[model samples]
Target: MTDLNALEDWAGPLLRKIEPAGRAKLARTLAQQLRKGQQERIKAQRNADGTLYTARRPHKLRDKKGRVKAKAKMFQKLRTASYLKAQGDAKGLAVGFTGRIARIARVHQYGLRDRIAARGPSAQYEARELLGFTVEDQEALKDLVLAHLDL
Candidate 1:
């Protein structure tokens, strides 16, 4: 599990010491980095464990013999809708999809079962680390925080 509290603890003091504008800037930087990470995951279609995301369940567009009639890119809408929001107070950032896309992403991220009218009952998907912080990300966040601190 992600130690988000630990990250908050590490950032709290530094954020408190900076001016509000600086703090917001730092927060935006963090959000940008997080957004980049998420975009990379979508492009790679692999989880943090280096495993490719399970092939998307086949669709119902099949011909007479039960062969697929058409192919569609998986998660295309979800990928396109991914976004980032840096809190104005500089206390937090959100990196994920919004609206309907948000619901779909959560379902996939946790491998939760859901109903798809076109596809029938959905299978449990493999849990994918959609917004995990890598060691490199942590180091970079630390550096960004330190750079904004008064020391």
Candidate 2:
């Protein structure tokens, strides 16, 4: 994950220039934009660095013909705006998974070893950067800030 401290430093001056109400609005806008980008990337199954996510483990169940069943796309519901959220206030903004889903997201985000199911075997999931500051996001942040200032 990109260090947010750096972003805070870079954005500090520009954000300070805005009035409280405008800053709050800008924060909401930024959060929404970032959330949209993240949803797109997750749908594409790409990491923050633009690399393809490690494929999901193959299903164990087989068809009558003995072929393994094709796995469904990963994180379909999890990536939706309901499970994932974008919220902001005067202080700052955040785009992330909310509720219990966050625990599942964290498992994949850090490649942690966890149980596959209750009483099932544990496995190490590969790290998939579910969230991070990408290069494009950095540029977009700059553009958004400049545009907001212009308004």
Error of 1 at 15 (Å): 1.5
Please tell me which predicted candidate would have the highest lDDT against the true structure: 2
Model 1, which residues run further than 4 Å from truth?
A: 58-73, 81-88, 118-123
Candidate 2 residue lDDT tens string, 100-138: 899999999999999989899999999998887887787
What is candidate 2's CA lDDT for residue 98?
Answer: 73
Name the regions of candidate 2 deviating beyond 4 angstroms: 1-3, 64-70
Residue 104 displacement (Å), model 2 = 0.2
- Compared with the true structure, what per-residue lDDT tens digits does model 1 show for residues 1-151? 3566888897787678778777778788877776676667767886755568788766678567857666764555555433433333456666666766677678878888777755787666766656556655677778877776744
lDDT score at residue 8, model 1, on the 0-100 scale: 83
The TM-score of candidate 2 is 0.87
lDDT (C-alpha, whole model) for all candidates: 0.67, 0.87
